[model samples]
Target: MSDVHGRSSGTGRLVTVLAWALLLIGLWLWGRGVTGVPENPARPGTGDVAGLGTATVPLPPAAEPLGAAPPQRIDIPELGVQAPVMARGLDSRGAVDPPPFNRPDVVGWYGYGTAPGAAGAALMVGHVDTESRPAVFYKLSTLKPGETVRVVRADGRVAHFTIDDIRVLARDDFDAQQAYGPREPGRAELRLITCGGSFDRASRSYTANVVVSAYLTGTGP
Candidate 1:
């Protein structure tokens, strides 16, 4: 089953995610000119923030793939984020597994692709907010470009990424090319995605998706 985006879709499975991504544009029109409401207000989280590359800083170059990975975990003390390991590969449904958004306990694996440290954008999608809780990505938008975001891969290696840019792009703008673009050799990049901009009550969605692009840096998990 291919998605409306011309990607694979198990209908029930990938459709919901594609809907959230695409419908965000409709939500934007509905909430025109509106910013996000304080749905789950908390202390402002911190990480490196870059604004379209104006304040650029040097980053560690991409390295060789670590090949097979050893067991590891991803932890973010700032947001109290901790999650177990899950390998993301193209599933039968053809859609990726979305990261756990509302709750911080579970982590999302990039459902449609490889386990990030492998090659392309280690795409990780988390819930900006679920019905019951403030998901792991509740504060993702707060991250600025050039800010450092780290990931501990299963292979006992840590890959650090310095954010390059943060964009509030419509679902229409999500291209597999950009969304899952190639990374530097041995360097692992990542993209954290979730609903952003404005949320709609009627459809229960957001106006846009916040995509944070980061370049690779650092060592083991």
Candidate 2:
């Protein structure tokens, strides 16, 4: 698969193809390239975690209070994503990190700014390519608008979101105000990000980013 997971978040040039694509997609995919992908070397709850609205610029407004999202699976059939809910937070770059694939028994979170299901645009990102093999989110860029995305909570409650749109962008095009900025008090939005565009070997990064936006539907059985 492709190893182009996670963007540079303005690191230093996006490893040629790394930062290139996700800037617009909000730190799109990540790396490594292998099957049975290495069980996240990251111990659960080990990363210097930041609860929603912690370190992000200006700090987004508080998230809608949740009754503790029960542990469960978040699945987006269209993209073939099915991972246990764990906390995903910002990678070294301040951009949100997605849960690693293939281990959704618990819940892996990308714990950075906003909670995954909170108000505004809560995001969950993942990988699409690796130098060796394709990752869970490899095809995440291909999801069509209106496709159904599902997140099952520990309480057996499932929240369904229907995609509103999918677009590609450049790193410079990334704007937190629009991306992470809050929406109406009760408004809920979801975004899934990944790498895309042509790979520029000289730069070692992709030319653009792939983004998916969705709106909450409701929890179901």
Candidate 3:
């Protein structure tokens, strides 16, 4: 079934509204001011600050899809990142809750939504940086097309996804359907999200969000 965002339902509208509200709340909690739009977060002439370009890379034809299982760990070999996965729910404000600042090493999976490797989009979010130092997803913007992200499941299966695109969308352009909804129907997808772009000293928040889009390409034991 298509997700609520794809349909013309009241719930879908609510989700979209809540999603956008959460974006603002997240920025606020992370130290960004609600007033005044800042410049694009990414450096000029590299990737545009508004959006990241997308590429259609097919998953490995031989790979089999896995059943729904909670993710236990995540490994990005190219980035040398290996961290435990923690299930996180939305806050009272209906935003995807982030891991505590004290545990910068942990990544939060949107537990209320589709699990990783399931036949839908799975979301995982991390901090770009803590108040004092870099966080688990500080290098999220560095991920390139064709890289792989492996999510080990509680059932002992690993769902491997291929990076298809990376985008840094300004807060004003943040789209719930694009950021949190499914990319392709019947395909298992993954989104690694974190704050990005230039840090706005005046606002005390990052001006944009770095979103890495990937699709299930293969699986492992």
Best by TM-score: 3
Q: Ranking by TM-score, best first?
A: 3, 1, 2
* Clashing pairs counted in every model: 28, 47, 2
What is the RMSD, in Å, between candidate 2 and the native fold over all Cα? 13.5
lDDT of 3 at 113: 64
Q: Write down the TM-score of every candidate.
A: 0.63, 0.61, 0.76
**Candidate 2 runs further than 4 Å off:** 1-71, 98-108, 182-185
lDDT of 2 by residue, 86-185 (tens): 6664455435555544432333444433344544456565555545455555566566655677877655667677666666655544554455343445
Off by over 4 Å in 3: 1-52, 56-64
Model 2: per-residue Cα lDDT at residue 65 = 33
Report residue 85 deviation for candidate 1 (angstroms).
4.2
lDDT of 3 by residue, 52-145 (tens): 5665554354245567789999999877899999998766655667788788889999875668887777889887665556678877787777
The list of candidate 1 runs beyond 4 A from truth reads 1-55, 68-72, 77-80, 88-94, 99-104, 183-187
Q: List clashing residue pairs in candidate 3.
A: 41-197, 41-198
Report lDDT (Cα) of residue 112, candidate 2.
Answer: 35
